[model samples]
Target: MVIATMFDHRVADGYSANMFVSSWADITRSQPPSFLPSFRRSVLNARRPTIYTPSTANMFISLSKLPLIQVDQKNEPNLDQDSLRSRIYYIKGDQLKKLQLLASENGCQRSKLESFTSFLWKITAKYMEDSGYLDHVCNIAVAVDGRRRLSEGEGVEKEDLMAAHFGNVLSIPFGRIHSKDLKDMPLTSVAKEVNKLLKTAANKDHFLDLIDWVEDQRPKPLMSRPFAGTEKAVSIMVSSGQRFSIMDKMDFGWGKLVFGSCYAPAARRDYYVMTMSSPVKTDDWIVYMHLPKKHLNYMETHASHLFKPLTTDYLKLYD
Candidate 1:
């Protein structure tokens, strides 16, 4: 059974998404040489599909409370190094089987696997410092669809059917706990925390309240990016854009997309994870992750059997 769904706007193919990207490139290219070289270089070198990677350089404006200083802390438990170490692990075959089992036993879906895994990793890292598990915190930010939550009446059937449903249908509910806490506590207790957060965010009324809260906080308009103060947090946002009706609409001269997924660059030390429908097989999914090298190394050593490397062929990166 599908746990969540996404509705995409009708577009011929992934190429259609490139139109806006191309325009952005053109705009940047047409700019005069007097423009800032850094900005000019960024646009000129932009790729067809851009992935947002978090960098500790010049992105943050230091406030009085937190000095706007960039520190190199790969050896320390700093956000700069931690975010770089975070990575996405792809699961299939037997590993997928084990994950499904864990999700089923916990009365959840495979979508929750990363957070669950992160929870366990954090715990093990704490007590067994010598275990080589990196000291980190794991937080799962589940994406909530706001279409139904914000829609009027029973909702327009056609709008729901079409992938064109726009507006902010996205909401992220996060579950955070330290690695040491998981290590000292039982799995059941950890699961409870995960479930509690999921349930609270799943409520329709709760989301409405959230919208109100955000409106009051921002007053004007704001983009949905990670909060600045959360630089030290190891949070992962999980979004399921598989149900977007647009995947089937890939017909801009080229054949239909065998699969479609989103790409998230390692922007911060915090974990960023996304799961989308695999074009190879509808039942399967393709997960894209950009994590730090240290965490990726640790996961590979310990959980190597669970994750399969996503090759360029599978993602059609060559094409």
Candidate 2:
């Protein structure tokens, strides 16, 4: 589930309607010429032509930690102004292994991808318990990129190159993992359930069907994103293949970026996670997440040992 803290109703209102419309308009306007060189070079250097390998240059693993229990009225973090703070935890090595074991027991592959994610949800549940926020329901919205599936080709060239050609092709699938179930079940069980749900929705046809379904439900035509009051549940959106190769190409004659990450504002209290290529290191990914403050605090206290600080130097958000 995506969870964001808004300082006032006005900010939330602005984000819910106006900002989205403006952002959408800007996105529809035109593709900047600055991106052309990168796209052309990438396409031209295609040796295998069927498979595109993600850069493994400067990979760094980091974790986001949040509190397990809900923060009550008295314990809630200060939000007097319009600024709010939240955190996301990262898991690695042994903790990741444990998650893999859990996933294996739950009938899912013990791959790094599956294990790491299972651990996050497990920790999210723990945070809810520790912070007294277990009563609410949480949803995990997996944002699938539809370009490869929607494209008209049948090779890796289409998949790898399309992201550069098509700007923001995406589909949000609601992985509605309830808070109660997440709290009660073991990590393994939760992994199984999550794996099942994700598998069912991870299909080209499923995306096409979703498109048709959304088109059919017009009048109040809405984009398939979480936190749209579409489900009244906590949901998160996860995007993979952190399009970093294009970053080097995005230079306007300025020095290359040491690192970069996607930032999500606290508009919806529902959780949001974006997995992008780690600019500092290629083999690693930088996951930008915005979740509840209570959960953030819990991870800090309990899972402090797992994550590296998201210092400005590492993310290059500054300079």
Candidate 3:
């Protein structure tokens, strides 16, 4: 069985949507949900006196100041949404293991997601270099869920409460490097950069501070900081869906759920990459990409060994 949901990004992010789907599955199976959804507004209320960190403010830009930002000076125009495209690919488990090993070489430990993000960042930089946009900044962002972090040190009950907390509890932390710098860095070093960026927003204090920051910015629209800056910048959002467990647990007595993935609209302008576990292959990954046509073509031509188009053959559905 295959199930899918189309949602509005303005209203909710992927994490919230994933929770909804998982909860639905739990109800269907007559089992309690692992992460229950909590709707209490006080759950994320701003702290007393509303103290926040400057770093929290750095993650987002106020809409009022957005018009003054400069466009890429290299004469590269903003990407046309019409040129955006989506592709689905599967990465073999062995390939991911090898990437992790390479990224962790020389006494540096890195997660598979971090390793993959570094590789993609490098590929993007390479594309920029080939296109004569070496001066443009390459921005890579990861969406970090803050529920557990917010509940940290509060006891298992609190943690469970947070795990079930519904709505958007996400922070997008990004690292920006000049294309030339990214092009010159080793894969391990790039992975280190990714880890460093993620560490900034993956903590309890960060989320609490973010809540306060949002309280301070109320009534003024805001957006992820990376998206608001340089016109010449190339930015991509990488979200991890490994925790979703959709394929294995989403079965509601309808046999096993197979071939589940996200579908980003082709007309959306931002670049996005999501990594989900393979339904049939335990160690493998199903990568969903929404990026520029040229960028996708570049990856397909240059990194064919690492990224293979997802097909029925890989799923072994045909007898």
Candidates, ranked, TM-score: 3, 2, 1
TM-score of each: 0.60, 0.61, 0.93
Model 3 weakest lDDT span, ten residues long? 72-81
Taking the tens digit of each residue's C-alpha lDDT, what string does model 1 give over 23-104? Answer: 3333545632221111111211223343322221122222333436464566554333444643444455445555545544
Give the higher-TM-score candidate: 2 or 3: 3
Off by over 4 Å in 1: 1-89, 103-136, 152-164, 184-189, 220-227, 230-232, 245-249, 265-270, 312-319
lDDT values for all models: 0.46, 0.48, 0.86
Ranked by lDDT, the better of candidates 1 and 3 is 3
Expressed as tens digits, the lDDT of each residue in 154-218 for candidate 3 is: 99988877777677889999999999889879999999999999999989999999999999999
lDDT of 2 at 271: 61
lDDT of 2 by residue, 264-303 (tens): 5555544656555555554544556676556556666776
Q: Which candidate has the top score in lDDT?
A: 3
Which candidate number would show the highest TM-score if scored against the true structure? 3
Cα-based RMSD of candidate 3: 2.2
